[model samples]
Structures are given as structure tokens and as C-alpha cells.
Target chain A: MASLGSIATAPLRAEREGDKNAKSIVFLGLLWFAILFAVLALVVLLVTAFFDGRTRLDADLITQYSSTVFPERAGARAAILGSAMVIVTTAALAIPLGVAAGVYLEEFADPRRWYNKLIEVNLTNLAAVPAIVYGMLTAGVALSIGLPRRVVLAGAIALALLVLPVIIITTREAMRSVPQEIRQGSLALGATPLQTVWRQTLPSAIPGIATGSILALSRALGEAAPLLLLGGLVFVTYDPNGLMSGFTTSYRSRSSTGRHSHSWRFSRSHRQPLSCFWSCCCS
Target chain B: MECDGVDVYYGDFKAVCDVSLGFGYNEITALIGPSGCGKSTLLRSLNRMNDLIPEARVEGAVTFHGQSIYAKDVDPIEVRRRIGMVFQKPNPFPKSIYDNVAYGPRVTGMKAADMDDLVEEALTRSALWDEVKDKLKQSAYGLSGGQQQRLCIARTIAVRPEVILMDEPCSALDPIATSRIEDLMAELRDDYSIIIVTHNMQQAARVADRTAFFTALADETTGDRTGLLVEYDLTNKIFSSPADERTEKYITGRFG
Candidate 1:
């Protein structure tokens, strides 16, 4: 027992000495500095935004609509409503389509076939394409499809397209993580391929799928180029009544605020917009 | 169920060759062999479960109730519903005990009113009801290894199958749990035909009414190995007086 303790402790001492190397110490310090910089930046930004926008961050911002004539009194009611509408529509369009495509590829499609390989390669390429390019594509599509100009529906469609590849990739990875034995067990119980995927595989993968979908939605929510090209107007004073109504998103306001901050030299009027933008992006 | 001149292959390589075996209703048949001797492959072939593997192919015929199961017009799904399986490791779905048992009946569209009674009966028949009766809503993963294996058995029986194929069902279990499973198999033999694959000869002797001994034959030139059935007989005869030298050598501990 004494010799066993020495044997274990000898390795642990050697490990401790080895972990204190100059190269690793330097690398760890650099990593810690990077993390500290990020947290410090976030803390400074939130504190500044809180102090600048506290007066305007009240119930009126949620209930009142935008007004260009009285820019000081204008709130984000229309922008918030439009953001909610686009997000709901984007989720409604993207989730089922993305999950179904993932299931088909992972559970049914034969990877050996050139058709499947082609589709898979294209999906990866699509994910790498910039959001601005998707905005351009959605613009062309909206025109050809005869959609009315500056509608919330067009913005939602553009955002859905932007995030579809992300959702599909994550969902496929989630499904792939399920053990093959679980599938075999379900198949042995007389389940059809469709039934096995729907009942057994999907339920087991819900947690992973849910996590991936939230990440994808966050990515979609941050996109401004797609909304801009899809004809999201800048000065819509009224809240959107339906999907086809003219709208402006929080992203639209944030992007406009970023431009205004550079030109206005940090004026009092720009403070509220900057703070609202930060809160919208972070929250 | 019966296999007639059945040959199983993975792409071009033969796994099990020319196996002609018949199973009587209400009897337990144990397939015993060394590892890689294709006992599990043969069991999967009986219910057309090998169809799930893209590379696996079967020649000749496997029949159920005198109907060829692999016939082009027949659905493999229908065959599996009547012939369920249990794996080496207990694989209860990550679900409540009640849902695990109800899965088969629900997928196959049994009446909702009869599901509770059916689930209870299956749990009782597998001898798991006494231990898990109160925690029916708990996840099957919370059960011990032995209990999980028994839960799998209950799930298999819940489909109202005429045949049950078990591949090393008790290999991961303790001796006491093994005996419990053996006793349950003996009781179940009165209701359903069972085919079990085991590396343990003692287990075969304990629970099986009939035993089939499979051995691997190696070709020296190509270094190819194929599993072939050597002898099948009553359990007592196979253990006490094996006809083949290989079977005798294996049982008497001369060689694998």
C-alpha cells in the first residue's frame, strides 16, 4: 500500500511539473487574456448603454410606434412587433423543412449515390455563402414571385432561407449522434423506417436538436442584410397588422443607428438608439 | 419457422452457408458457437432483420407458417411484427417502462383500451412486474441490467409475436439473473417459439430443448472463414453424446 501510494503520487508530481512548462504557461496566459478582454468589453458596453438609455427604456418603448418627425420621443413598438412577426414566420417555415431534410439525409439517403453527395456538397457551400448574397437572391426571388414591396412576409422568407442550411446541418449532426443500436431495436419491433425515425430517433434527439435550433435562430435574428434587401422599410410608423404589412426590424434600427453614431459625434439623440440596439442584439 | 439451404453473405463474403434448420412451435432452440461463427447472423436472417443492412444479402429461403418470408411481394415489416428479437445488451428504449412495453402495440395500432392490460400481462410474464410495478412511469434506464433485459423481453412479447429471437440475452447478466432469465424462458416456451444464440454451452444445456452447434471452417488457400452448422439434436444428447468429433472436442474442453 505504501508502494502503491508512491507510484500514484510520483506520476501526479511529474504531471504537475510537466504542466508548468514555459510554452504552455504562455499559451494559457494568452487564452485567459483573450477571455478577459471579451468579458470586459461586454461589461463596459452594457454599463454605458444602461446609463445612456435608462430614461427611454420604459413601457412606452414597447407600446408606442416609431415617428421620424419627433425622433426624440419615437419608441420601438413597430420594430419590436415586426421582429416578432418575422421570427415567428421564420421558425414556422424553417423548423419542419430543416428537420425533415435532415431525417431524409441521415436515415434514408444512400451516401454512395452521386445525387446525395451533390446535395450534401451544395448544402455546405450554401452555409458558407455570405448573408448579403442570400439577401440578393431573395431580392431577385421576391421580384419574380410578384410579392408586394416592403412586406414583413418577404423579410421572414429571406431570414428563413438564410438559416435553413444551418438548421439542417445541426439537426443532421444531432440525429447522427443517436446510437445505431436504438434504431435496430426499434426496427426489430416492426416499425417502418418512417415510424422509427418519427417515434424513436426524433424523441431521443430532441435535446440536441433543440440546442442546435436555438443557435441557428440566434444567427438568423442577427442578420440585417437579408431584411434590407427583402424591402424592410426604415421609417414605418405603424405596427404591422399582418404578414404582408410594411415593417421595420430591430436589426434595421440597429444598422441605421450604427451609421448615425458615426456621423452624429455621440449626440444625446443617438444614445437611446445605441442602447436599444445593444439590448436587442444581446438579449 | 424454418431455414432451407439458407446462405448469408456480406457483399461477396459468405458468413453462414447452406444452413437448413426447422423450429417446432412452443420449443426453445439454442444456437451455440464460438465468436465470429455467424450464430447472430443466422438469428437475424430468420425474421428478415438482415434487410436493414445494405450490404447483407440472403440466398435460399426462410419460411414462417409455410410461407417464404423473403418473397418479393411480402413485407419485411409484417414478418418482424410476428417475430420479435432481444439483443445481447439489454436495450430498453430511453422511455418510461410503460411506454417501452406499449411501443410495439402502439406502432402496430392495437386498441387503446386493451393496452394497459396487455402491458401488465407482458410485464408479469417476464417476471419484472413485481420489481417495477410501482415505477411503471419511470425511465427504463433506471432499472438494473437484469431488470432492463427482462423489460426488453416484456416489450418483445407485447407485440403478440409467435417467435422471439434472443442473441446472448443473459451474457451481460449475473448468475442469479441468468437463472431467472432461464426460468422465464422455460415458462415462455409453453407460449412462444424461442431461438437463442449463446457462447455459453452451459446456458444452452440449462434452458434449451434443442441445440444446434455451429463451427467455423477455414480455407487455407484464401484464408477465408465461413460458419457451418455441424450437428443439432436434443440438448441431453448434444451434451452427453455428441456425434461429431468437433462437437465432442468442444463440449469436453479439448478445443473451441
Candidate 2:
């Protein structure tokens, strides 16, 4: 009976192989098309940017201040410096605070407690809130406190608020990736929870935390809506000297019209390096 | 270190019930049981290592050196400092072998001049010095599994604990490494009190001075499993002539 069954199924097995081959070939073709489609879009975007603004790429475009009448002589010096200061300030404010909050939530806080649960739920929701809303919060606070409007301080604070949740979420994930065994080993050695976190947990999590912080900072650098709401959308000829000084980021400075177009190209130039760094961080 | 009528609870569920055991100075006591028998839980309670879990609470008393470790004024850090642990799987920090051994003393605030001596002494005591002496600066990950386990032992010893709790220390090792660790246990027993939890009955017979057998009791109504100590006696007596029928059955491999 076994020999008869094998003889009967041999032809059927060969026919099924033909069907499987056709199915796999179709899937392979579709996958190839999808990959090509993504690559093509990216290639087109890069080529267009290069072709449209190739001539504007020069020393003057980065060194000299923006010009109203001489569009050709315009530069993004102030916007570049302003964006750098704001991002650096944002990173400084967000990273430590975010990582600390993450450690508390992941390692210390009891998940069953109502208050800790509330914080967890709220943080998840806040991460989804639009960047424009964070701008409004900064503007409202600046106005209520009677602080000078549209300074680098206000913008950086707004950006920090926007990216804080991202950093915290990523940091929590990074901390979670560390095995429970490592924590147990450290604590069994008689180290306090704080000591375990500082010595064992945090060091292992640095790579993930650095990557998250960089990605969040890159997103902060590209945000124009929040800065606009913070009243930093106006043009500034001189670079920001300090955190409290008037400043204009690249995104805030980009607009339509002749000199604005030249300045917008300069803004794109500023964005390029940020995005490049972001990709490297991801890899 | 000793526990009296200790009941461990994970949140609302009882994990281990009415466990009473004691460890004398310069002696080795082994806790033996099948899987999920809460032997590890009882072992962890000795040093209050269970306190790391937010909801894991222990009823009754676990005293170290005549002081209740769970007393309101006593710190768990101090308890752990006096009673270190070596885990089932060797966990060497992703650091140099030298640093791995040095970590415990450094954390406990040993003087810099004394740290070098402490690290070297620990490595030598754990019997890993000869194999790794020349590669002290190399990463701990470079060591074999057995070597790493010994390194962990050295790291624990560097803290100078009065007692060391080892939870299935040789379960992850080969027969040769297991034998090496068994020998190390015998040697270390002359210095510090050791409490080991093992599934291997032969291992308990080999190294343990006192043996305690834990068995899981399944509640028919609730279907909840809770571990309880069945018998505790001298290792030779427990192996040769056990008092309890259940202990005999388990030892003879009739049933868990």
C-alpha cells in the first residue's frame, strides 16, 4: 500500500512544484518592484535638490548674512548658528531629564500604582501630540511669564518639550533591552538600585540612548511650525550671541519670493547635514 | 544567616510557605528540589534579595548575625554586603577580567591601594588565576563558561561577605566544570557559610554538610502550587536514611 501511494503521488508532487514556482516568482517580482519604487523616489528627491541649488552651494552661502536686495549674495549664517544653538540647548535639556525619567519608570516605579500608570499613559499620548501644540505651549508660557518673545531660549525650550517624550520612550526601550539577569547579578552583590542603574544599566544603555537622542534632536531641528508659533519666523541679519538673544532657525527662515528663495536654499543646506547625521545614527 | 517560618509572597500569590532553615559559620547547606519548588525564592530571602521585586514580600524573620535583616532600621544594602550571591548563569560584566574581579570591592568603597591586592587575591582564591593571570586586562567575555562562573565567584568573594548564596551554580556547567565548582565550594566552606540550591541530588550528597528538601504542594481547589520544606537533616543521614517518605521517594527518583 505504501509503494502504491508513493507511485500515485509522484506526478502530483511535480505539478505542485510548478505551481509553487509560479507563486514564488510573482512574489519575487513584486518585491523587486517595491524596492525599486522606494529607491527611485529617494534618488529623484536628491537629484532635484542637487540640480536646482547646485550653484548656491558656496562659502558665501554659509558665511555671509542674508541680503534683502542682493538675493545672489544671501547666506544662512544667522539661521545656521541659531539652529545649532537651539539644538544643542535642546539636547542638553532633554537627554539627562529624559533618561532619568526613563530609568525611574522602567526600574523604580511600580506599574500597578495608579499614579505611575497615569504617567505612563500620559507620556504615550504626549508623544503623539503635534509639534505645533508644543510651540503654542512655549508661546503661552513666554507671554504669561513676561519673558522676551522669540529668543533662542524660548525656541530651544519648545523644541526640548517636543522631543522629550521621544528620548524618554527610546531610553525606556533601551533599558528594557538589558537582561533582568544583569540587574539581578548587580543587586545580589549588595549594590543599591541607584548604584545598579548607574554602574550596570546605564552604561549598557548608552548606545541606544545616544541613537534615540540624536534622532529626536534631528526631528527638533526640522520643526518650523513650533518656532513660527514662538514668533521666531521673522528674519535676523545677525547670528544669536547667546540663549536669550533673538534668533531665527533655518526652518523659520525658509519662505517664498526672491531673497527668501535664496535663503530657503540655504535652509535646505542646513537640513542636509542634520539628516545625514541622523542616518548615520540609525545605521 | 537563618530564616524562621518564612513565607514568601509574589503579590497576592504565596510562592514558598513556612520555610525554616539555618546556615552555620564555615559550613555548606544545600536546598534541593524539583522545578518551580520555590527553592530559589527561599534562598533569595536569606539575603533579602527578594526586596528587589516591588511586590515580593516575606513574612517572618530572616536574621544575619543575630540581627533581623528585615527590621525597620536595617538596610538591605548592608544585608547584601554581608551575604553575597552567585547566580545560576555566570554574569560577568562586559569588562576586563581584572575589572570584573575588582567591581565588588570598588563598589563597597575599598581603598585604591588595597583594590589591586583584593582583586588578585579573589582571582587566586576562585582558582581562575593561573588560567587568566596573563589576560587580566582582556574582556571577561573572552573566558570559557566555567572560567566565567569562577570569575563570578571571585567577584562575589571580593566583597568579603560572611555568607554566599549560590542558586544552581553548576546547572549551566559541564561535568568537569561542575566538579571544579563542587571542589571550590568545599574549599570556600572553610571561610564563609554557603547556601546552595541544587536539583542534582548527587551534588548535594557530595558537597553539602546539611541538606533540605523542598516539595511543591498543589492545592486541589485553587490549583495553585506552593513550595514547602519536607525534611532537613545532616547530608549523610538524609541520603543514607531519610526520615520522611516523600524525601526518600524524591531521593530514589521514584517521583518529584
Candidate 3:
């Protein structure tokens, strides 16, 4: 009976092999086409940027401040500084808050509760809201209370609102990747929940949190729509020194301590978050 | 030590029902049954290890040295500190071999000098001292499966718990490792009250002073499954001449 069955199925197996080889050929063809298309699009973008603006791009272009009536002399120094300040402050504020919230939601919170579901849904929606809306809210509410209008701090709070959901989502995923057995082992050894999370869970989840925070900060750095409403200039030679100094500084300083200290610290820290931020804004 | 009317439940489903048994001081008691017989569940309930699971619930009383473990305000952590556990799969932490053994003592706030001596004593008792002494700082994950299981045994001993609960400690090991662990169990009975759960009947016959056989029953109305203790006696008598027909069938390998 076994020999008869094998004879009957042999030709079907051979035919199936032929079909598999044909399907593989089609899959490889599609893969090559995708790679070629991606390369072509990248080449087109680089070539166009070079041909259209190459002559105008230089040190003077970066150094000179913008005049509303003179577009040609407008530099990106103030805009760059504004972007930097907002991103750094946002990261400083959001990472701890978002990661804590994520940890609570994933590890500690009971999903069956109504309030947790509400928070989860609201965060998802907040992530999708337009950046300009956050800017308007920050300018109207944050500035009116005590934070001066058009300073980096207000912009930071706005950007933090925009990127917090991303950090939370990524952090939750990272925390989830840690095996349940590890947590159980720690708890079984008589450690409290807080101790287990702080000692075992957090250390293992750090690499994931760092990667997510970097991605969120990069997105915040390149954002201009919210910053436009939050009052970032195209060019300012001097950097804002700190939150207080930036709020008080006038529009016409040749050199600000904020830029000097930031540049110095950037060179010193050499960490991925700092370098990645530099690449985002400088490029 | 006695477990009085102990019942374990997972959400709405009861896993083990109305089990009452006593383990003598400095004696080994083995709970043997087929797969899905609630032997492991009953074993975990002895030390309150099932508390780690979100929905697992335990009722009734487990007493250690005549003190009730399930009383209100009894700290589960304190219970676990007094009653240690070793699991089927060797789950040594991703730490050095020295750290693995030292972890329990450190948590209880033992001084460094005492911890050093305890680590050495525990490792020596488990027969793993010579194999890992030279590379005490190496990661425990680098050790072979048998060595890792023995390291777990050493880790449990370092805390100096009054009772040690083991759940299929030798199931994942080879025959040689199994023999070593069996030997260790025999040696350990001099100081600790040992309760072991194993599917291997021969292991229970060899190392256990008292053996309890458990079996599952299905409720007629609800069709819910729950485990019940079938028989309990001296290890030799239970194997050679069981009181119940079910126990005889299980012992003879005719049915489980």
C-alpha cells in the first residue's frame, strides 16, 4: 500500500517543484525592481538638491540672519538653534515621563480597566494630531501662563507632546521583549515588584528605549511647521544661553553662550543621541 | 510539616482539590503521577510559588514547623525565603556562577564574609564545587545543562531554607546527571524537608521515603477536570502492593 501511494504522489511532487521554482523567479524579479526604484529615487533627490541650491549653500548662507524682505541672505542658524533647543529639551522631559508611563502600562497596569484603555486610546490619537495644532496650543496656553512666547521651552513642550506617543509605544515594545521567566525569577527570589523592574527589567530594556528615543528625537529635530508658529527665526548668529537667557535675549546678538556651550557639549558627549541630533539638524 | 485541605485554582478552573498530607522533618516525600495530574501545581503550592502567576489562587493551609503559611498578613516573600524551590528546566540567572549561588544570601542581607562561606558550602553540598571552582566568575549560562541544574540546587541551598521543593529537577538531564541529582537528594534529606514532584516512578521509588500518587477526575455536571490524591504510603509498599486498583494500574504501567 505504501509503495502504491508513493508512485501515485511522485509526479505531483515533481510538478509542485516546477511551480515553486517559477514563483521564486518572480519573487527575485520583484525584489530587484524594488531595489532599483529606491536607488533611482535617492539619486534624483540628491542631484536635484545639488543642481538647484549648490551655489547658494556655504558658510555665509549658514551665518547670515534672515530679513523678511531679503530671502537671499536668510541663513538657518536661528532655525537650527531653535530646532536643537526644542529637541533636546523635549527629549529630556519626554523620555523619562514617556518611558515611565510605558513601563506602567505594559508591566503593571491591568488592561481590563476602563481608564487604562482611555489613556491608551488618547495617546494613539495624540500621536497623529498635526504639529501645528500642538504649536498653537502651546503658544496660547503654555506661553500665556508663564512660559514666555516664542522661546525654546514652549517649543520643547509642544514637540514633547508630538513625540511622546512614539517613545511610549517603542518603550512598551522593548519592555515586552524581556522574557516573563526573568521577571518571575527575580520575584521568586523575594524581590519586590519595584526592585525587579528597576534592577532586571530596566537594564535589559535600555537598548530598546535608547533606539526609540533616538528615532523620536530625530523626527522632532526636522520638524519646522510647529516651530514656525512657536517663533523660530531663519538665522541668528548668537545662540540662546539657557531657557531663561533665551527668553530674555534680544533679536540682535553676535554670539550667544547657548550655542557655544551646546557645541562644546556635543563634541564631548559623543553619544549616539547627540550625534544623531547633530546629523538631523546640520544636514 | 502539613498541607491541610490545599486547593489550587487557575481563574475559574480548579487544578488540584482537597489535598492533605504531611512531610516529616528531615525526610523526602515524592509526589508522582502522569502528565497533567496536578503534581507540579501541588508542589508549587507548598512554597506559595504559584502566587507568581496572575490568576493562580490557593486556599487552605500549609504549615511549616506547625506555623500556618497561608494566614492573613503572612508575607509570601518570607514564606519563599523559608521554603526554597528548584524548577525542572535549569534557570540560572545570566550572571557569574559565584553570583548565582550568592544571590539568595545577598537578598537576605548576609554579610560578605558569611556569603563567601555559604556559597562554598552550598556548592560543596551539591557536588558542583570542584567543577566550577576554577571559573567562579564565569557566566552560569556557559555551564552544561547538568551543571546548571546542580548550580540551581546549590543556589537553593545557599539560602538555608528549612524546606526545599523540587519539580521534575532531573527531567531535562541525562541519566548520569539524573543519578547525581538523585544522590544529592538523598544526601540533602539529613538537613532539609524535601518535597519532590516527578513523572519518573523509578526516581520516586529510589529517593522517596513516602510516595503519594495523584490522579485527575472529571466532574459530571461541569466536565471540569481536577486532581485528587489517589494513594499515599511508604515508597516500597506503594510500589510493591498498592491499596487502590488505580494505584496498582499506575504502578504496573498498565494505565495512568
- The estimated TM-scores of all candidates read 0.90, 0.91, 0.84
The candidate that wins on TM-score is 2
lDDT of each: 0.85, 0.87, 0.79
Ranking 1 against 3 by DockQ, winner: 1
For model 3 the local lDDT of residue B206 reads 96
Q: Which residue runs does candidate 2 get wrong by more than 4 Å?
A: A1-20, A251-263, A266-283
Q: Chain B TM-score per candidate, please.
A: 0.98, 0.98, 0.97
Task: For residues B139-215, write the lDDT of model 1, one tens digit per residue.
Answer: 99999999999999999999989999999999999999999999999999999999999989999999899999998
Candidate 3 lDDT by residue in tens digits, A135-162: 7888889667876766777778878888
Q: Write the per-residue lDDT of candidate 3 for residues B7-108, one digit (tens) a residue.
A: 899999999999999988898999997777799999888777787677899888888888888778888887887888888888887789998888777776
Rank by lDDT (best first): 2, 1, 3
Error of 3 at A47 (Å): 4.1
Docking quality level of the chain pair in candidate 3: acceptable
Model 2, position B139, has a per-residue lDDT of 96
List, residue by residue over A157-186, the lDDT tens digit for candidate 1: 888888899889988999999988888888
iRMSD for each candidate structure, in the order shown: 0.7, 0.9, 1.8
In what order do the candidates fall by DockQ, top score first?
1, 2, 3
The list of candidate 1 runs beyond 4 A from truth reads A1-18, A21-24, A251-283, B111-113, B219-224
User: Chain A TM-scores, one per candidate?
Assistant: 0.83, 0.83, 0.72
Residue A253: error of model 3 in Å?
18
